[model samples]
Target: MSFREKMLWVAFIAMIGGFGFYFLTLLTPIGQNASPDYYLGLLFFIIGLTIGSMLVATLILFIRNRSEVTFKEDERDRNIHKAATQIAYYPLLLGVWGSGALFHNGVSTSIMLNILLAVLVGAESIRLGYQIFLYRQA
Candidate 1:
């Protein structure tokens, strides 16, 4: 696979793993009664884990594919990225609007915040997945 493709895979996996764990924990009884400080700490831990993993993965991929690491994107890659981003935007917009609606309906701030985070993660996942698919098809 190309260097960019490998990086995309790494990022996608890291994001899913990190956010999946967070959401799963939130579903537990302990999470429901957790203080704001606990949630803040958990968020920091998750963000750190995700970013650190992605950086490490990128380093490994760079070492393995040093040549490709220096290669710049061409028209096809740019187009694929553009298309994926364009496609992902719809979900993001809808999610934000949905979150607003939830707020309007008197949902808790925590729930709305989590929903926003979920939307961002989901949109990113979709973008990465679409890029991978397009690269493979091409």
Candidate 2:
């Protein structure tokens, strides 16, 4: 696989892991009544995981294919990305509007935050998968 493809996979995994961790923490027995300190710790944990995962993924890619690290996307990659972005954009827009409506309808801030995060992660995963598909085609 190309370095870019590897990067996308890494990002996809990291994002999924992050989402899982966030939800798990939120669902913990103690997490239900988690203190401010608990939330702060969870926040830091997530940040650490995100940074660490990206670093590890990049390091692996560089070690495996140093030359490919510098490679830029060609026309096909660009076209695929453009198409993926187009596909991802509409739902994202609608999500934002829906979230706003929920807030207007008295939804809790926490719920709204979760909704936004879910939308973002879902859209990104779709885009990444679409990009991978295009890369494979090329």
Candidate 3:
């Protein structure tokens, strides 16, 4: 598989793993009563896992195929990225708007943070999914 395709697989796996962690965390009473810091920490943890996964995948791909490693993007790549991002945006916007409404109604910061986290992760997962789909469309 190509490097980008491998990275997409890594991202998708990390996203699923993060969600699993989130759900597992939510099973605890402490998680049920989330503080803003708790959500932020979770967000950081999820992001760290995702970026770390991509970085490790990149390193492995580079080592495995040093001469084949490429950092080039052509029109198809650009178009796929743009289209995926646009496809991901609407849900993210809606999530943010929902968070805004909740905040206006005096909802807790933790809740808002969770909403934002969900939006960020969900959007990223969709973007990556779209990219993978496009890559496999050949």
Candidate 4:
């Protein structure tokens, strides 16, 4: 697999792991009042997954293709990246606006924050996957 493809795969896996951690933590019973440690642990899990995946991806790329480190993306790759980014941006913007509307309609802050994070992760994953597809097509 190409470096970019490998990076995308790592990112996708990290996102899935992050979501799994989030759901597992959320489903855990904590009686009446939940401790702040649960939330902190969730945040730490996500951060660790993201950083670890990125570090592994970088190491793999450097080890496998160190000579190609200075390579520049070609026109097709650039086009695919741009199109994917554009598609991703629309959902992100819509999500932000929708969150604002929800808040205006009296949604709770915690709900809004969760919605925003979900939207952001979903959009970014879609963009990365779409770009990888385009790269394969080219």
Best by TM-score: 1
Return the clash pairs for model 3, or none: none
With a 3 Å backbone cut-off (N, CA, C), the pairs that clash in candidate 2 are none
> Candidate 2, after superposition: displacement of residue 5 in Å?
0.7
In the predicted model 1, the residue pairs found to clash are: none
Ranking by lDDT: 1, 2, 3, 4
lDDT of 4 at 124: 88
- In model 1, where is the ten-residue run with the lowest total lDDT? 31-40
lDDT, candidate 4, 62-89, per-residue tens: 7987767666887876898899999899
Worst 10 residues of 4 by lDDT: 30-39
Listed in order, each prediction's TM-score against the native is 0.96, 0.85, 0.83, 0.82
Q: Which of 2 and 4 is ahead in TM-score? A: 2
Model 3 bad stretches (over 4 Å): 27-30, 34-43
Deviation in Å, model 1, residue 28 alpha carbon: 1.5
Candidate 1 error regions (>4 Å): none
What C-alpha lDDT does candidate 2 achieve relative to the native structure?
0.82
- Compared to the true structure, candidate 4 yields what TM-score? 0.82
For each candidate, the alpha-carbon lDDT, in order, equals 0.92, 0.82, 0.80, 0.76
**Candidate 1's residue-wise lDDT over 1-138, tens digit each?**
889999989988998899999988988999988987888799999999999999999999989999898899999899999999999999999999999998999998878888999999999999999999998999
Candidate 4 clash total? 0
Q: Which residue pairs does candidate 4 place in steric collision?
A: none
